[model samples]
Target chain A: MSGLSKKQESLIKSLYTRHGRKKHNLCICEGLRCCYEVLNLNPQLVEIAVCSEDFDLSTLPAVASEINFIRVPQEKMKSFSSTVASQGVLVVAAKPEFSKSDDAPADPYIFVLDRVMDPGNFGTILRTAKSVGLTELWFTAGSVDAFNDKVIRSAMGAQFGMTLREFSDLDVLAEELRRFGYNRIFRTTPHEGESCFTAPDLFEKTAIIIGNEANGAAELDGSLSLTIPMPGNYESINAAQAATVILFEYVRRSEGGA
Target chain B: MSGLSKKQESLIKSLYTRHGRKKHNLCICEGLRCCYEVLNLNPQLVEIAVCSEDFDLSTLPAVASEINFIRVPQEKMKSFSSTVASQGVLVVAAKPEFSKSDDAPADPYIFVLDRVMDPGNFGTILRTAKSVGLTELWFTAGSVDAFNDKVIRSAMGAQFGMTLREFSDLDVLAEELRRFGYNRIFRTTPHEGESCFTAPDLFEKTAIIIGNEANGAAELDGSLSLTIPMPGNYESINAAQAATVILFEYVRRSEGGA
Candidate 1:
C-alpha cells in the first residue's frame, strides 16, 4: 500500500528490494482488476492493503482464516503504492508458486512470446491472450518477466490460474506436444504466404510464435511459419497484438470456426 | 517530463492532463521501444534525457544534430518520470496531428472502436489495426480519448501520419460508409453465427464494430443488430484482439485466394 507519507515511503522502498519482498514472500497488486481477480482466483491471500478510503471490500472473497485487513492509513497509503490514484485497494499476498506441471491445463491453449521487451505490450497481450481461450502461457529468449508488476496487472489475474513456462528452447516440450498431436507451429509476419485466419485449420495442436518488437524472428529452426493477414501501410503488428490474433485464431478454429 | 525534486510533482501531474500536455504541446514516451521507435521514425524529437553519468546516445539517429543532452540531475529527473530507473531519454514533441481529411488514400481500410477503456489494449489495437490495413480510425462516443497519454503511449506512434475521428456515432457513419460502397459489417462474440476465420468473405466494403471492455455494445443502442462470429471460449476475445482478427480476415479474402 502507498500513502503520502515518509513512513510509507520507507516501507515501499523496502518493498522494492527483492530480499525484503522475498522475506515476506508477498508482493503488491495496485490496480483494481489485478487485485480483484487474484482475490477471486486465489483463496490463499494472507493480507490486503487498501490506500483509498472509498474502497469497498465486502465483496472480496473471505480472507484466509488468520488474516486481518489494513486500513488505507489516510494520506500515508499513496506513498506505498505506485498508481497515481491507488484505485481504492492495494494488496500484499504471498506469491503463488508458478509451476508448469501444475498450472498447465490438461489441454492447453497457450501463448508463446519471444524476446518481447515492452512491459505494456507484454501486459496487453496477456489480457488479450486470456480472453481468447488461452489457459497457459510461456516466454523465452529474453522476454519480459511475467511476474514484473506491469505484466501482473495487465494479465488481470489470467496468469493466476494458468501455468507459466520459461526456457530458452522447448524442444523436449515441443516433442511432447507433438506426441500429443499438438505441434502445428505458426509464426506471425506481414509478409506473404499463409494468413493467420487460416491458422486454426493447420493444427488442433498449435503453437503461435510472436517475436521481438523490432526483430521479426531470429530463426525458425524447428517451427512452421505463418503470417497474419495484413494489407496495410505498416509492415507488422506489435508483438503482443500479433500473438493475440494468432492465439485467438486457433481458439476460434477449435470452437468450430467462429 | 517527471522527475523527483521538491517540485517535479507538478510536472509529473502534467502528464495526466491533455490540456497541460497541449499547453506545453509535448508528450512523453516512457518505455524503450516508445523511445527507440521515436528515434527510428525521426518524428521531430526535441531532446533525449539520459540519467547516468556514463550513459551514451551515440548510436541513436542523427547524433550529429545535437540532441539537447542532459545527464540527469538524477533525483529531479527520476521524480519527473514514470519508470523505476530512468532510461534518460523522454522524447518531447508537439503531439502529432491526424488531419482526418486531406489527400487521404482513395479507399481506406479502417477500424472503429466504440469505447475501449484500457489504454494498453487501445494501443495494441491501434498497432494491430495499422498492420492489418486499418489506416484510418474512429472512436465512437463511449471510447476513451484517443490522445490521452495512456492511449498515445500505448499506440507507440502508430498514429503517426494517420487520421483519427473522435466521438462519432456508428449509425451515422455506417450509413455514410454505405454510400461509399462499404456495406459489409461484422461483429464478434463467443456464441454467434459464423466462425471469425471462415465467415463473411471479405473482398468488398467492410466495417467492423468492436465494443468496449465490458458489456460490449450494450451502451451503444442498436449496434447489436450486427451479426457476430462466435469463438471457442464462452468469453469473447478481448475487444482489440477481436478487431485485429476480424480485420485481417478481410485482407485474406482480398488477396484473391493467394
Candidate 2:
C-alpha cells in the first residue's frame, strides 16, 4: 500500500477551497462514483487516485492503471473526504478546458446560469443538462464554483462529460451568444412572456438562462423572456427544478413530441 | 415579549424527531418564508408561532394575531432550530389531514413517492408537485417522513398547500389508486417503457411514481413504466429533477402544448 506524503496531503486539503483549486488548476472528485467517472470518462485529466485499504481496486476502470494510486487507512481517507460518510475513494484531476473560440456551432442549445449560488442546485443543473445531451454549459461569474465539493458530489460526475465556461457579465455573454448564431435567447420568469410550451422555435439555436435561487435571472438585453405557466399558488419552483423542466421540454420537442 | 415555557421548549426540541411529530400530531415550520406560508395558506393548522425578539411581527399576516405567539432571544431560538441559521421564526402546527375516503375524483393526478429517502429530494418534489397544480401527494410508508425538518426547509412551505397521505405497502397503494380511478399508473426507469412525452393519455387519471435515490421504484403489479430519455452517458438524473421534468410535462400537455 502506498502512503500519501505530507506535501500530497496538504495539496488535497487545499482543493476544498475555490482559490486553492484555481491555484493548482485541479479539482477533487470524491466518492466511489465520482472517482470512477473521472477515471472512466476523462482519464486524461486525472492526476491521482486515492482509495482506502478496503476499496476494491479491481472495480476501477482499466484506465486507472495509468494514474498514480495511493492507498491509506480508512480513517486517513475519511480526513480528506468532504462528505459525512466517505465512499473510500477520491480523485484529483485537472479541470477540463472548454473551448473559447469565436466559432459558433450550426445548432446551439446552451444553458446559461446567471448567479446560481446554491451548490446543490448548480450541480443538479449540470446533471440535467448532461442528461438532455447538452455538451457545454455557461455560467455567470457569481454562480457557485463548478468544482465546489458539494456541487461535484451532487453532479455525480456529470462534470466530466460537460464543457463548462464562465462569463463575467450577462451583457457580454449576450453579445457572444448572438455572435455564435444563437438567435433565441430565453430567460424564464415566474409569470410573464409566452408559455415555454407554446414558444415558437424554442429549440433552434437557443440559449436558455436559469437564474439564482432567491432572485430570478439578471436582465439581459434582447433576450426573450418565457414563463413555465405555474398554475399553483406558489410563486415559483426552485431554480434547479425549473431548469430540469425546461431542458426536458427541449428533449421532448427535439424528439418530435407535441 | 413572552418567553417559551420549559414544557414548550421541550416540545419544540422533540418535534425535530419523527416519533415526536407523530405523537404530537404536529410538525415544525421554520424560516420566514415557511412560517409565512403556513400562516397564510393554512392558518387553522397553526397552533403556536414562535419567533426571536428581533423578528418583526408587523410583517406577518393578519392571521398571526389569532395564533399563540411566543418570543425569545435570538440565541435561545437558535438552540431550538434545526437549521444553521433560523430565519428568526418557527411555527408548530397540526399535520394537515388529507381525505381517506373511497370516492374517486373526476380527474386525478397523483405523485406516488416510493422509498424516497433524501429529504431535499422529497421537498423539491413537493414544491414541483404544488407548482404544477397538484393538490395532494401519496407516499409509500418506507419513504422519508413528509414533515422532516430538512424536507420542510427545502420544500419552502409547499406542504401547507399539499394533501399528504401514506400507504404501508405498494400493493395496497396500487389497489387504492385503481379504486380511485387512476387507470394509468406510471413509474420511471433509467431507460425503458414508453418515452414520457409520447405516452398516450398520461395526464388523465394518472399516478406517477417517484422512486428512491439509490433503488428505483418499488414494483407494483399492472403499473405502466415510462422513461425520460437521456442522450448523455450518465446513468440517470436525481429523483427530484426527474420528477420535475415528468410533472411539468403534465402541465405542458394540459395547457395544449406538446
Candidate achieving the largest TM-score: 2
Model 1, span B1-258: residue lDDT tens: 333343334554575676767676666665445555666554565433344344456645564245554555656556656656665555555566656543333444346677788786687777766666655776777677565656766676666645676645667666555666656755444465455555544434565667778766533333323333433232344576667666655665565432
lDDT of 2 by residue, B95-199 (tens): 887765554543357788999999999998988888888888888988898998789888877888777878897888888888877878999889889998898
Name the 10 consecutive residues with the lowest summed lDDT in model 2 chain B.
B99-108
Native contacts conserved, per model: 0.65, 0.84
Tell me the spans in candidate 2 whose CA falls farther than 4 Å from its real position. A103-107, B103-107
| Candidate 2 local lDDT, residue A19 | 92
lDDT of candidate 1 at residue B73, scale 0 to 100? 61
| Fraction of native Cα-Cα interface contacts (under 8 Å, chains A and B) also present in model 2 | 0.84
Show the lowest summed lDDT stretch of 10 residues, model 2 chain A: A99-108
Record all residue pairs in model 2 with backbone atoms less than 3 Å apart, i.e. clashing.
none
TM-score, B chain alone, candidates in order: 0.76, 0.95
RMSD of 1: 6.1
Using DockQ as the measure, which candidate wins? 2
* B17 Cα displacement, candidate 2 (Å): 2.0
DockQ of 2: 0.79
